[model samples]
Target chain A: MSGSLQTLSDFLQCLIVGLRLGSVYALVALGYTMVYGIIRLINFAHGDFIMVGGYTLFFTIPAMLAVNDKLPIWLAVIVAIAVCALVGVTVELVAYRPVRKKGTNMTALITAIAMSLFLENLAQAIPAIGPNYKIMRRMFSNKAVLNFLNISLDWTTLLTILIGASVMIGLQLFVKKTKLGRAMRAVSEDKQASVLVGINVNRTIIITFAIGSGLAAVAALMYFAQYSTIMTTSGTMLGLKAFVAAVLGGIGIIPGAMLGGLVIGLVESFTTGYISSSLADAFVFLILIIVLIIKPAGILGKNVGEKV
Target chain B: MMNKNTKLKGYLVNTVALAVLLMAFLILNANFKTPFYSVVFIPSLWQISYLIILAASLNLVLGFLGQLSLGHCGFMAIGAYTAALLSLYFERAGIFTDKKAPVFIVSILVSLLAGGLLAAIVGIIVGIPALRLKGDYLAIITLGFGMIICNVINNLPFAGMEGLSKGSAAASLYKTGLGFGNTLKTKYAWVAIVITILCLAAMFMFIRSRFGRAIESIRDDEIAASASGINVSLYKVGTFVYSAFFAGIAGGLFACCNSSLSTASFAFTNGSILNSTFIVVMVVVGGMGSLTGSMLSAVLMFLLNYVIKNVIKASGMPLFVQNLFKYPMLVYAIVLIIVIMFKPKGILGTREFSLVNTIEYIKGKLGKKAVKEGGSK
Candidate 1:
């Protein structure tokens, strides 16, 4: 390949990696934005749900694969999603419900932080799941399916992007076309109004958490597959980055999360590829700070003034 | 009449109480042979003092300023690394000549001040843009700033190279010591305790000052405060800088006490003093905006942590059961969650405990009873 072609391919490879990473971020960010939109509380433990999902797959996949070598990847994913959704609902109902009822934002935020800490410590305390990082069993063969001009694309990356796109589109359709989606939008816009209009507000909120957490599980599967290591505290940074993506995308807007995730993922990949890899995290945060300063409402977020 | 005389009396009483407490700590430090003093009291005292500085500094932002800053630990890290590195350099340079006592005191004081000043400068840089964002947005931005700070420290060639090979091009400037020497010995726990008391007093006085009132007004309502000519932006930035300054000092003291500094010590991960959530938990549990509450809660929480960990270690239990004790943070998390859920306003609910208030309350109750008795007669 020519030098220019090499450079182009390198850029394209980075772009591909960025999209794959961005999709996972987008999945997590969707949950974050949705929760923030409805409850005005950042469920800091939402990221821990991803960790739980990974662990679920870690434990279940190995056992099932041993019994039947031909076990489908989707079964493990389905099981993980179910487990994560249940965990999400329990967290919402138990730790978050009372704090939200109290209607104190600081309290709610602190409670969320506590939940994050609790989950992390609990995981660390558990036998065989201590503080050490565990290598994930590769469920999918990450073979390159396409190669052109010195650039190769892996099947996992393609599937990740494809799945991410499909999920985003599916979420968009679900929110736009379904009755529950309308209720979710209504509750997010005005809880009291939604309640008055005969919408089961509590049920809708639980469903939102379930859906968001299910997406997190999917994100976790993709994340562990890519990185192939799981730590109790891994979700903390991932969650923070996803939260930033949500905010970057103009939090509370669905499309914005997707866009923000892509931007963050791209920035991170380019920084790691072109600049110092050590500075990638710093660059990501710097971008967040700059984006927040330039557009406090986020890239796609509408600026709303606080009323007296 | 409740006037300057009463205020002066309150100050005098508080000073006397502080002096007595200092003397007690000095006596304890001098008598290092007692297992109770060495193992339980000294460690807990130093931790309490460190926490007081952290919790109180965070309160200035969370409570008085009504701005949530999740990156307080970032400032603390700046302080820790700066102080640790400087003290290490000074020790290596043989700056402390024969006069051990005075030199040690002066070096520690200088390193701490330098740490605080550097951290305050960073705070100003961070706070300028960060303070512009409100509420949760501000919290997340501060958090990002904190993670960025940690990442920088972890990757920087100047630090975090304790384990790396020397021949490598990225070798650090200073050798990462296993621990600080006699310079930061546990005997200096009294010094930390005294500094903590002074910081608490300063914060208490600042909150009562005109500037503090201006800051509080801004917290109450920024639009109204600005309308009332209280430069909201200036106060917001000023308060953040002030808070960061103290948090930096606390970090300095922490480095001195622990005698080691690393990016791991300052990151927002599990078991780090720089864990933003843990600091926030301390502030909230102490009751935001109340110095007394912060101090009391800090002491209580530190004791709880120390006692629980020690007890678990000493207990004659199975390996599995004993292993569960390794997660003291789980207890902290549970306590924090309970506090948030049951008593969101915190134990003191922004109310400071004062001798004057206690005296007045007793007097009022006695007078009311006397009046009631007389009426019945």
Candidate 2:
């Protein structure tokens, strides 16, 4: 009886770990799906926005902590969000916008890759952040607040769940209810029709990038909160994983990104916990290839016929 | 207007020129060690042979089949590792004990053939699902495939695979069964040149056949090609597999030439030109769907890389900027971006380089009345 109870607890602990990772992926995957919906771009650099947001937090949090001991985290989170949004807008304007205007499919993909490489290598070139690991000191206290059925829920874990849930719920509500959100949907569904309907396609697209990048900032906070290490190359791997989640949930669908993120997170965590940690990535990709083979459009994506 | 006679002559001229270039490299290799001129451009000739094969094979998939695959290096790595392991097994078995010419040649032939065959099989499996998807999905899946190969290799246990690894991630090819160290170094160029010409000839002949025409039609428009009774899926997979086969051969050649073999040499983890992105850039710069363009761009880009590296070294640039130059991927990334943005069709733009056309170009350049053969770019 004790052995069974211990196994159950271990499983629940694994669940909590999966959920913690799922939330960060969910946030980044949301941004990916949104931008992809609007622009039909993979935006290989979307993951780097998390790093940008992370650097912002690293610089701003310490400064804000000097001002007020307790209120710094929230302030720093807001600043990071704003900075990421601004950076997203700037990247869109400088790199993606010109390519989009030209309307070459190959160029768009190449430019996205170039932008991604540029950010990664540029970050490495900087003297302060030259390819070394920068530590994000622990943010939340690890006090176990609840013990239900012999499963302990710590303060950090609970807050991580709350943060992911609240932010996801808030985003869902905003995208579903607001006028601007409707404009975003309109642009994504039909760019030319949206233009005829008096929707500013470029502005809506830019705003979508901003919102997506801002969400990436939130994901960064969640990442630093849990993993606690940031490096120049970390963003590319994170971005690739998030991109997989976005595709697995159906590329353009909003709720699908969240569901996909959780599935990937669970898959990853279970693989790491049950199988060898080294083989987790291979398993994730294998699963993705299998899913794609079975359902090419993804779980939530609709099968749209091509017009001849 | 020049007739088919002139065109055939032009092709003959091109083939002979390629032979001459190979002979020159062989002569240079036999006499001197690396850094023949001490100008940091020694591998420019040897590197071109494999890169030409890589670029041309990639063109078959990306240029002809109209698939944007970024995981091409994955197939190459499969070939390299497979060839290396096979050679290691042969060495252990003592078939290559005396290092005799005939036995060593047989071993290399078996290993290279096995490597290429293995890569092709994997390509067919990867291509079936990947080719079905359109656009970005295919690209991302290939990207995932490359990473998975890298990770799996990194995790491959040392229990059965002797020589374990040099670095934490790189597998060793120190005592390969192909030949001795000095001899392999000298004759490797000859092996590369022969294999390269054979692969290029096979690819060129295939590209000019009925099958090649059908594949090109698929790239032009999927719906129209299907309407015209082209088995789109069949042709797509066939071309992709064929491309991967040659890519595997290229990888086998790479394993033969290089002293060290690492996962970094075959993936985007390091900012080297060995990855899929670099190959894609070369194909695009050469002109997708143009075999001659692929060849020309491969040689030109290798030279360009040599030039860039030498220029960076010779210049008294800033410390950080010089450090940045250590990664050649940055410049390739920029080059890809600029090429894609400005000249989407690339330098050749679906045209083959003809020797006759070059003669005409030089004649026109010297202010002579040049006989026009075809259209000029």
Candidate 3:
């Protein structure tokens, strides 16, 4: 492995690749941050939502292509997102709500893990989507949309970044300007206060789940774009990484998650690109631990010292 | 509530009862070479004993300390590799004794101790900063450490040691398969049961100790405990270390139970959090903070899962049920979810079960029944 880059083009290429992958992680991390911030539950099943999205694409692409010679890629994307949102909300209502009301945080945590297990293993149990790697049919071509010197950015990477940016911006504005967004902010700030003020806490939480799952859906599409194959275990790996992103960027802050994801993706890409490939995961964790020890609140997150 | 004298007596009586029950259980396995014994019952017992150790150890951290740790299997992996490697060295060098059984006896103890001690040291390193984080942050940190342990195990270089295979992961193991290899049938089962008994007893004793009481206090009210002069971090980290040590011992017993040592054995979620998550399931099902519950649930869940799997394979069943059982892990998920949803306090709910209490309750009931009959007459 070369410690030094041969050219600026190579550096730009690495940067582009990192951004493309980082965007997907950022989107997922945002979902993680939102639900965790509001409810204080680590939704382990959040990653399975991505897997659900992948399966949706698996079903929809051919169906749409059958109707016409061309695939309605945008329509498929929308459907996948909707399906994932519905599944996410349903899981919350069925599994989490009951536990939240009556059980301890540990019980809730266990429930989350079980839900994750349920989703992945359920996929494996289904004959069509059993524990085998299913190759996704390529709907888009990988061609260089922009080239400068030796630096070239492909269409898939460009699309992933654009879609990620648009979703994030839209989410940011919605949270800042919308009535529901203020209610979400107020609820996270103080649930008791929010309820006293006539805000429907449960509804806000359900909406958050829907939005988080929706982000996972978009991330799934990007994940498929990057790698043409999907497997049952893919969610676990992606979930773990996005979780690292969530923890790295401050646990509750949106910008922190975004920053954390990009940093993780860059660390991973650069480590694989310049250092030993086997060491990439170790390096990411090492960086996370170091940053956390130095700034436990995470980047872009406000620090609150533990007095007791 | 009870004096030390009574507690010691209780511990002793419990040990005797356990010894009798476990021995009879083993006798059944030794006598029967049937598929049910070999495939379902025997393996379930072997797994139950060590899993009891794992669940009890995790309870020390999660239940008593009130902290969630997602990476406990990392400690188990550390123990498994260390103990396996050490015993292998002893076996290869011909140091302990010429006889195979004697060599096994001597090396296993030393190796288990070494494995546990090393795991404790690593636990301290992982516990310090992680303990400070608290709640969910602590969980993620522990999870990070666990992943790092996995990465280290999968990539650790053990090639330079003489008589050991070169490479990462399972390379440095004693051998690819059974140690002492059926020379002593059910030998590892004996090792597992003995260790489980010893570990569970130790946990029982520790939980009653003054430090253990302090640890429980911290769990209930950290600030209040700290105000009362409890060393919160020390106790928290101590409990964490204690848990890690036993988890390592469980790993050693785990290595003994298996034919070979491999990275996959201590895998994280890639195996569906195979060893890690299920161990947590046992703790939860047993009821948090209850050692007895941990042991019972480990035995019960393993039996249920194994039985259902074997039945699916051996008997005719509806395709739907068989399909559900096709992935055993799916059943585990469903089991965990349902258990939490319905019995959130778990089967025991921080309460310990004892034969003495049960006998007394029965005696009182019979006496009451007799009195009621006389009064009616």
**Candidate 2, CAPRI quality class derived from DockQ:** medium
Check candidate 1 and list the clashing pairs. none
lDDT of candidate model 3 versus the reference: 0.82
Please identify which of the two predictions, 2 or 3, would achieve the higher lDDT against the true structure.
3
Single out the weakest 10-residue window by summed lDDT for candidate 3 chain B.
B159-168
Q: Cα lDDT for residue A252, model 1?
A: 85
Ranking by lDDT: 1, 3, 2
Off by over 4 Å in 2: A147-152, B1-7, B32-34, B37-44, B98-102, B158-183, B296-311, B314-332, B363-377
Better of 2 and 3 by TM-score: 3
Residue A277 deviation, candidate 2, in Å?
A: 1.7
Q: What is the C-alpha lDDT profile of model 3 across B209-298, one tens digit per residue?
A: 898899999989999999999999899999999999999898877776665666666655754334676677778889999999988888
TM-score (C-alpha) between model 2 and the true structure:
0.91
Report DockQ per prediction, comma-separated: 0.73, 0.55, 0.65
Q: Which regions in candidate 3 have their CA more than 4 angstroms from the true location?
A: A1-7, A71-74, A147-150, A305-308, B22-39, B96-99, B159-185, B373-377
Complex DockQ, candidate 2:
0.55
TM-score of each candidate?
Answer: 0.93, 0.91, 0.94
Local accuracy of candidate 2 as per-residue lDDT tens digits, A1-308: 48988888879978988898888888899999999999999888898899998888888888888888778374688999999999899989988998888736776776787787777777776777777889986777767898787778887778877898999999889988999999999999999999999999889989999999999999888888777888877777788888889998899999999988988888888899889897888888888787887888888988889899
Fnat of all models, as shown: 0.78, 0.42, 0.60
